[model samples]
Target: MQRVRTAPRHIAFETRPAGKPLDAEWTQITTREFADQVSAFAKGLIASGVRAGDTVMIMAPTQYLWAVVDHAALFAGAVVVPVYDTASPAQLQAIIADARPVLAFTGTAVHGERLAQAATASGTEAPQLRLLDPDPAIPNDASLAGLAELGTTVTDAQLEERRLAATLDDVATIVYTSGTTGDPKGALITHRNLVGQVLNTAAAYSEVVQETGNTVLFLPLTHVLGRALQLICIANGMRVAHLSDPKEVVQSLAILRPTFLVVVPRVLEKIEDAAANSAREKKVLPLWRAAHRAAVAWGVHLEAMDRDPGARAPLGLRLRHALFDRVFYGKLRAVMGGRIDYLLSGAATLRPELARFFRGIGVPVIEGYGLTETTAPLTGGRPGSLVAGSVGTPLPGNAVRIADSGEVLAKGVGVFAGYRNPVHTEQAFVDGYFRTGDLGSLAPDGTLTLRGRLKHVIVTSTGRTVSPESWEQTVEQHPLVAHAALVGTDRPYLTALVVIDTEAATAWFRDRGDAPARALTEDGLVVCADGRLTEEISAAIHRANAAVSPSERVQAWEAVVIGEDRASEFVTPTMKLKRQALLDEAASITDGLYR
Candidate 1:
């Protein structure tokens, strides 16, 4: 309503029609149009026996329909629940058993079926199921059009009464955490938590959420940060386009040419890797390497300058950077729409070099830090202070501190009321601050530099404690290395299960333009046992080792050529390594090296 009042004609959202070209012009939805639709859907919800405080589960990808349903649920004064589209039937069942919503809506037949099965197994009556995108295959109460038809019976006064009855203190959503190291727990996020966070974040980082600025949302709405950002776009009336599929990111960017974009570290890594692999294929590896060095150098210089006013780049470095910007950087920018100013990254740490390279290319990454309990961001990059390695300072009205045990503690408006399970909620907080379970240090200015997850710390048989983050992140930055999971708990020393970047590795090997490369598919991911690629892996390990003491250095590692299996058993849907699963196999692979 406020968005409509301020910007009646402003395009609040954009969406591409299904089966359309990725670069096609988006279908814009104005503020008034979106509000009218949401109101109609809310009337339908109320007419269908939904009352205030009732839960509505949304299990779908990031799409326009998902946004409409989310707002509509809020308009009806119901508590919304989000489930990732990647969820298996079992995971879906677990959350359904926990949340026990009154209705559920999904974008596809597969998720609809999964939710149906989950609800059946939840041991309670199944919720009223609806489809956002109409599916004849899966039976449902109604589709979007059918819901609008249902709303014609409900009066405007009824919808208003329901919407106004809800309060900020009421539980607005039950957000389940991504189970990286443990089981997903339902965190009860109140309206205050959600609205307070977006308002404060917008005030603190107005540059990112400006009215004229726009961005594409590719991350799943199941994540707290994704939902928070969606709300921010609505509250600020920022133009937003939805891209459900990650594969179409390039085309979407080329078409939208947004001012800033939201991203995770993995996205940044893949972008740089794609460029490098393209260079290798074109026989311009040497030129690309020189340009890459210049970009990283330039980024490092800028970061130094950001921290200290007097810091400056050398004359030679400046000359090299300018030359490379014209010769190489411009082309790279062209691939990503040529208008990106900043990338907002969260959920994981970005390696220093990777972060610097992007900044060098003129798109600085603004890394933020928080969890589901924090309602997305506890700390984020301010406009003027961009810490290259840190997760910026706390947002307005939020505070972060390190406990005696090195765990990060947070207390703020963004912090959720509590977890759905009271016992879990009790364990999550200390005296007043929520136990973040992340180990981080705060500078005098309040910038937070994280070490690693407190639970991720590894202990060797020799009684030495090692945080695997630095080693894993350093190794992962290598062009050929996709992911590295360090394992050494109660063992003699550390070793890693390294995932070789098959696509990048194949391009690297095929640059010879020889018969071997032509027959590479039959060869099944050849790693060149004694060639430059092997040497490079060794060099990456060496670099990783240099960052740690003798005991903490990864002594040896086994390369796992992962392909087709995007998220194999060793990795979660979020791309986090299932450490316990790796630890189970670590002994089998590392017995020879340690023995």
Candidate 2:
């Protein structure tokens, strides 16, 4: 990739509205206006006693206010600590205490008040709190107007002073881990680290603009993927549209007609589900079946085409393209802007079957790997260089190596400075390389294949070290299981704590003449009106478990009802399991096996 010297001057760090004609097509915010808002918010923050280097916590959903508050804190030379919107009060309290923030910006009055109470309960130093709106009024308190009202016009002199004081080496943000595995730790990221990561990512996806012309942003901004993509968009001079609702994505695609997109495995799964259901509804029609088969066949052919550069296209390829374009490709494209040059998937592993299915439908799912600590996207499969099941080669300036124990080690300019806790910072690195804790191999073609996290490995008493993530992925692929965590560390056999997809489970029961007349509830089990495994449900679990090794097979399992009021059970923002909390609550079921 050629390095370009023409960097945009004046930083233009915030969203700027594209001039008229395109104005109504996007949410408009100019660079000057963005700077003024940041300056005003910084002044208000300073008056509230937030000093340089002090942490300012932000716990909010995706909104323009989130972007404003984050940039304001950075401009003020203060470190920003971003908290997930879905985090519980206790989780928020823990992070606030650990970071010892001076002030916090929350999404609503309810969460803001709850945070204050949680801090008091934890006996931690409570920071000054400002409520963002709870009543959902027009232009809520979290709106840009609300923040602008907090202070008067900031002078040019003041802006210059703040800008001059800011340094690239300074700690810009402290993003806490989602705590899916254990306690969350803040990953300390410097300005330079983030800037480098954006530059590197832009280089990899440069073809998206040169080839396709547009990109869409839908991931949560608090996470690394969203954060990094924001910077990449600015640096690449690309237009970005943010959508908070996943359901609105297809509609947005129709309007925006984005050429590229960043997505998670869950979103792709939904798309596949939609397509399959549509096909099933039209199955009775003979022409529908023929069209569907042709589309599926064409999808398979497209996947083959992707694999070989010089493969001759069969004459049937063109015929099917013309025949299936309206019924298949057109619908798929309508849901995805119909002109996407590439679709990038990360945060979790993409099932091989799903990847192939999408590739067959003409949308290439390029899987990548990274963490919050690496500012995301350490490795990505380039447009023409993609391989199934492997996160493509490391980005330029990033190095990847596998340890004897199979732990993946990464070293690069994009690597974060360290975790906020000094002890964790020291422990996370081994001989200067960041110990990713993830186990994976570097393939012969430079692609990276993730095995599982080292800490989550289940070591059987018989001496086999099995990665539950490997098995968990397969289990989750089952239609009934929404999410599954394979548990059984140091045990004879594994046991799964499964969260059944309530929608699919409901349909499964209905088809078997076992639909619940009313809701049935129980601990460690979900039942219809009649008490039983709902027929074939247990069989599905057994079949999923049967696919794994004997030691890794789930011996006993519990059904996780969707709306259960389990306080500490569920994944964190990054989608990692909260193992300690789950194990504690399920101790009775697990303890008997050890005895």
Candidate 3:
């Protein structure tokens, strides 16, 4: 925090209007200005009875204000607790009860009202609420602007004293998990964990973390991954633009021309799909297909060279790729603002195909592995030594090992102290290492290759265990698949419930001039008696099955239509499918597959 404050000449953050191009009139906050705002907010929080150890919850999306308040709370010697704005009222109430924050910040009035209602329902006094953007949608006790005014009288010495009084061992945050398993558990993160994360990330990425660059952060600050990036950007003195809404990311990308990006895999996939769709719309499908094939071939050749430096791409393919790069890859890169030099992806595995395509086109996606409990990254890919399928070696200062049960265990300064639940915390560690509950293996060079979540694995009646995630990754690669879940827990064989990517499927049918099967339904892609679409989907299924072992191959599958409501039921906010939740909701369809 102090380092950023001293770098007054540096633009700390750039806040752009929603839906506007990045160059459109945007507010730039210099490091000095950011520090002043944080100082004033810290004073406001302090004057409002916030003290060391008090929890201050920020229930909002990613934005400049959210970052300010988070820093201010820390400066005021208080613990920060962040809740996802998309969280249900019940989840909100549960977190409120657990953290018992003395003050809370909400991005919008709707969230303010929800928090108020949840507090009332929980029979606890609602925390003093401040709004990031106060509108008439709900009542707010005071606006962040108003709070900043209230804090104008605070002096720098007061803020410094508060900062000095706190130790690294002090609790800094209680980041609640997204609750894919059950109710969310608040993981206790201390000042040390935050510092360790920054230090280790810098060590792992070398200059990537230390060098200043232009970046756009769209990940929710509520998640540890997002929170870590926010802090890292500030600490590294990067010029950053914040996007609260993910939908605007693509448009903003072209305008921002960010040199570096931190993202989830879904965003990359969306970009790939959009690029393909754009090509088709422009009457250049043939060109796009040729470029894609060349990119894949180029990527393969590069990988081979990584293994054997003397290796080279066949001259014919190399020449074709170079020609296509000028025509296709250059245009695609412009969609990402054309300046992206590197990317860091986490939260889930990045598909190797997507990774290869981006790298082949010049923007390398460095996949990393970590969980909420690990404070963001335990393992990360290096700049030039990236292994497509592996999340490169553990970040410096972190040690990873696979347990006898195949669960990954991590011991590091970045690991969280424990969950808020005493018993849960007690069971989370073994021999001082945090049990990640993720199954993975370490390559000879120590790169981590994640397989699946232990709890999400399916065991068939024949005693064959399969990682649904591995199959799902391969299945979802098909353009028509919106989502897929493999099911067969204790059943005879594995089957899948697939959701169609409606727009893509519609385009597929329209392009083929086969319009009349049955309009895509809310129930999902309806199979025609013997239509080309059905045959294509079957072929996709066969391709996915071929990628896995016979025992793990999907035997039977059914496509289920998921309306907006059903979409939420099938996937977590983080985009991870809740296997049990989805299966229970689609019990009839799942059972029919076996019959």
Candidate 4:
């Protein structure tokens, strides 16, 4: 397994079963077949009016079609715009208008029709839309079927020419950010940008991958994290097992047994809660608690062993590992396929307590940071370089600096070529560095310690400033709290609106002999309803507030009883707080405070 410097001639390469190793079954995509599909799709796209430099919008779930559509579009010298399949009609329309795509590849007729209707409603002329189902036998419109039929006649020469003609500077894709404020902006990324990120990431984790051959693909392909993972797999010849449903992640892991997984903090938090709940239900918590104490004791001894390179673990700890396998590590590992080399958590800050706990249990969780504009990751922790509270050193060829105002600025080839709108593009970059809007400082060792977002900072009337994001992260870490939003910019003190983690809250009520009620209402406050706060909850909020300065502490608070699946009034799709929206909804509360 050598490091690959150049992109493969066929972006879709041959993959086959490595029969000798049973675990290598996931690496089954053959280069021949992949090349055939790429060639055929590219020809059909061109035959259907797609041309060089044209834009193609791709809206589909994480599946083989996503890869096909992206590669085919690239081969035809077209810019690709990948949209989340779950995007609202309004969001889809906005992206379509901004990109002004010449064609759209969709997963179903309903989705295509929705896009069409949205375009008509928005009064924007739409491109030719085509839909293809996962099942080949499903009948499609004559136009789409005709394109699909041409797959059989595409030649290898066409794919080769397309690849040869593609320059490193050519725009490969336009990724729209899940806007926290307004319509998402398209970030133009070239082939060089993506390839650089993949290569740099691969280099950072080469040691871990040297011993493992598989990586799990679960993030949305619409996101840069997912797209980067796909490229890394292709560049490194690693196998991928795609999982879309969050509920099926553990089950999929059992089947795929991937060596590594790149996931968001929410996913890891869910696993932690599930494991804890399982332990409690099985009456293993007490025993596991004792085991945890012993594990800590054994950890100290292991540290001593490390001082002597040739030393081995003592007999007592070895016996404990065997005895506690089922109660502790075994169950935890089973949920993660029992074979993960390392887990990379990004997209959001992971609680340090959770990261340390996972590491103590033999699962190393590395927390990192990046954005869509940075092509997913600018910094990540390596094996021994793991930092519990910091997003590790910047990737090779990347430079990170802190502005005077504490904003994190980055410059590198991995940085995107500005937003599609010139005004946004101008505002995004300061000098040549992309202003990340995140406030952070660089450690002596180069690790980036994230504080919070500059734009999200709350300034009190007394002139004290606070980053509500840090408090939000702290509150969300609680088992009962699913999401949190901190408010009070020029008022008395900070207050939060929180959504309970539904499953955890239901179980919490069930254990107390209470029948679970229907989902909480959006914008409905979740106080005691008797107009009193519980001592336990009060203590928790006080503790969270104590972590910040006195002026930043919550003087008053209320929870909105939002339904689990309803359009979140206080949160965005990426789970970012919709601060302005929350402020607007809580106007009555704020006004009452003043009186």
Residues 1-595 of candidate 1: C-alpha lDDT, one tens digit per residue:
7888988889989988776888666799999999999999999898788889999999888898888999999999999999887775667888989888888888766677778788888786688777877554543355777777788998888898888897889899998877666577999999899889988999998877888888888888888888899999899977888888877887678789888888888788889888887887788989899989999898888877877879989999999889989888898898888888788888888877787888898888898998889999899877557777889999998999999999999999999999878999899999899999899998988889998989889899999898888889988988788778888888888887776766767766666553332322433222234345566688889988998888788877766653353344456544566666555544566565576
Tens digit per residue, CA lDDT, model 3, 75-161? 999999999887877888898888898999988778878999999888878999898884444432377666766766777787789
* TM-score for each of the candidates: 0.93, 0.85, 0.93, 0.87
Which structure is stronger by lDDT: 1 or 2? 1
Q: After TM-score superposition, what is the CA distance of residue 289 in candidate 2 from its true location, in Å? A: 9.2
lDDT of 2 at 408: 95
Model 3's alpha-carbon lDDT is: 0.82
Structure candidate 2, residue pairs in collision: 17-29, 180-577, 299-360, 333-338
Model-by-model lDDT, in order? 0.82, 0.70, 0.82, 0.72
Candidate 1 local lDDT, residue 202? 92
Error of 3 at 169 (Å): 1.3
Model 2, 121-221: lDDT tens digits are 77878777765443436253344345456545555566457656868878889988877766788898889888788777777777874322556566778
After superposing candidate 3, which stretches have Cα over 4 Å from the reference?
4-6, 18-23, 134-141, 502-536, 566-569
